[model samples]
Target: MLDRAGYDRYLAAFNARDYDGVADFYVDPPHMEFFGIVITSRQELKDFYAWLHDNVEENVRVLNFAASETCTAIDAIVRITAKKDLTRAALDAKGATGFFPITAGVVQEIRQFIFYTTRGGRIEKVECALPPMALETV
Candidate 1:
């Protein structure tokens, strides 16, 4: 069974932008699905995170969470501040508003639903659902 403390630790690690710490919560070769893109290897996951860290600054606030014997689901609001201009294609792919141009330092809030399946107390698989971006005027 997934414990709340364990989940909290994961969240804390993630919010700290500690990729290595976050990776420790997952099994090697973890499976992840995000915005219809599937990442099956740990190396790929690390690379993806590296790219994200380089592109934007982000923080997540969990609004709700539920856990069962094998699965945990989290509903969160992710605030992202772009460090560079985001292309329309990239915005559209993430279900974000494509009409508004995303320039540097623009904050975008994304409602996210994330589900995790665990084995031996480590995350085995992750599936994430992201809605369209809601840009907040600073």
Candidate 2:
């Protein structure tokens, strides 16, 4: 097994919104996650983080996360809770109020499943399965 303590520190840094700390986890080519999009490459990853930090107002606060590194893959189940400051700056440019919500406290308790393919000790790629969406079927 990998050093659980070290891994915990890594995870804690991520939960703390320490982008640089999370950046350190990537060695060779890095993978970037922007909402539902993925971009690979160092410079692209940096740009992705910059945009994410600038535009996304939500924070990923991990309630709990447990990860296991197998011979060829890493599996993790993370419980994440989030709060978003939904701003209307973009909408305001088009003349719209900042106040609109179907209900208060839109916080979501989501279970995220992350699977990673590994080469040597570094993670190569990741696949994620998130909680179901709230939209009704047509």
Which numbered prediction scores highest in TM-score against the true structure? 1
Q: 3-107 in candidate 1: lDDT tens per residue?
A: 778889988888787788888888888998765456687777777676666777778888998888789888888778889887877756654442344678888
Candidate 2 yields a Cα-based lDDT of 0.46
Give each model a TM-score: 0.81, 0.53
**What 10-residue stretch in candidate 1 is worst by lDDT?**
93-102
lDDT of the candidates, in the order given: 0.77, 0.46
Residue 16's C-alpha lDDT in candidate 2?
70
Q: What is the per-residue lDDT of model 2 for residues 1-138, given as tens digits with 9 covering 90 to 100? A: 223454566567666767666665665686634235565865655555554444333333344445456322223433322233434554244232322221223443434555445455455565655546522211
CA RMSD, predictions in order:
3.6, 7.5
Q: List where candidate 2 sits over 4 angstroms from the true fold.
A: 1-3, 32-35, 46-50, 53-105, 131-138
